[model samples]
Target: MPTLPLYRDDFYLSTAEAYVSAVHDDGAIELDQTCFYAASGGQPGDTGFLERADGSRIMLGETRHGADKSIILHHPLELFHSDMLKNPTADQSAPVVGEKLVLHVDWPRRYRLMRMHTACHLLSVVCPFPITGAAVGEEESRVDFDMSETIDKDAVTAELMRLVNENHPISVTWITDAELAANPGIVKSKNVRPPMGLGRVSLVCIGENSAVDSQPCGGTHVSETQEVGAIHIAKIEKKGKENRRFRIRFGVPE
Candidate 1:
């Protein structure tokens, strides 16, 4: 069954209540609804835990999509241990289908990613080049642009801070699959397209009325640009004749 991904609608939701709809032989738990963000679009999946009625917790190592994108699977941290993963077995205490559980997201880690992911967006705005690739991380993030022009890292950093300090409001709006197909230019990635099989796509817009940017994305983000505080472009590496990878870090470069 397709799980209702609550994080899609509310990025700040760190906790939620849900019923376990399925528990796989390998120990992946599926919930009727979830606030955990699955791994997608260069952003890492969420890591957290599920709590039972008695308050016992099952630590989740990561959240990911199942055979179909609509099915979100929460993998327990214990499942990642070498022996357990090699011969996977469901713990005796594993929740049964229809059991209720309270989902708790590692807010501090998730908040960092949100801040970093938003910083990546601001980088795209400052660079204004076709994004060839990107990755959202807690300590550092990278946005690869398809351009040969040499640009100063410090200049990019300054521009990024300007947008961050401006504290522009960030908002999400939905567009139907057909609408996205009609206006393909709103997508900035040259190689990747937003998940479209789903009826609607999310557009993460920055600034009032999207004065800064409006692009399709399926990742969690901060509500305001200022929340992406103290970010800077640490380096720009030439990967190819026409490609440059810009590394973003949490604080100003030394």
Candidate 2:
């Protein structure tokens, strides 16, 4: 069953109501709709709790795609009982099929990741190099570029902050798979290509009319560059003959 991915439409949605459509033997629960973001494109899955009718909570370790992008699974981490495998009725607290629950995302951690992910986009804008790889983290993020030329990290940091200070608006627009195929040059990552076959791809546009940058990304991000706030390129490392990794961290450089 395809779960409604509510976060795709609203990045700031932290809570949503959903009903369990399936319960896997391994304790993974599938919902009819979810605000949880599945682990994809270098961003980790959401970790939070599901609220029950009795006010009890089911702590989820991770949210991920099951089978495909359509089947979103939420894994319960805290209340798993080994006996439940032998006897499905053993764990009374386990989410039952057709049960309704409220999903609450860990906002503070998610907000940090949102900020860092947005910073990675700004870094790409400043460097303008073909990205080889990237990872979004709460405290720090790294974007690897297919470049050999030596560049000053401080200068990159300054450029990133300049974009941040400018407070460009960030918004998402959808494009069909065929539309993306026609515009391959818009993609910046050399190794990772945005997932296709989903009918539509999301273009995260920064700045008015995408004056700053626009690219296909599946990860969540802030609404404005200023929300990225004081990001600095902590270091740049030579990974291979042509690859260089730029590390981004929050706060101004000391």
TM-score for every candidate vs. truth? 0.94, 0.94
What lDDT tens digits, residue by residue, belong to model 1 across residues 138-204? 9999999999999999999999999999999999999999999999998999987787777999999
User: Per the 3 Å backbone cut-off, how many clashing residue pairs does candidate 1 have?
Assistant: 0
Score candidate 2 by lDDT.
0.90
Per-model RMSD to reference: 4.0, 3.8
lDDT of 2 by residue, 42-146 (tens): 888899989888766788986999998888899998663445568666545688889999999998988999999999999999899999999999898899999
Worst lDDT window (10 residues) for model 2? Answer: 79-88
Write down the RMSD of candidate 1 (Cα, Å): 4.0
In model 2, which regions exceed 4 Å deviation? 80-92
- Candidate 2 clashing pairs? none
lDDT by candidate, in order shown: 0.91, 0.90
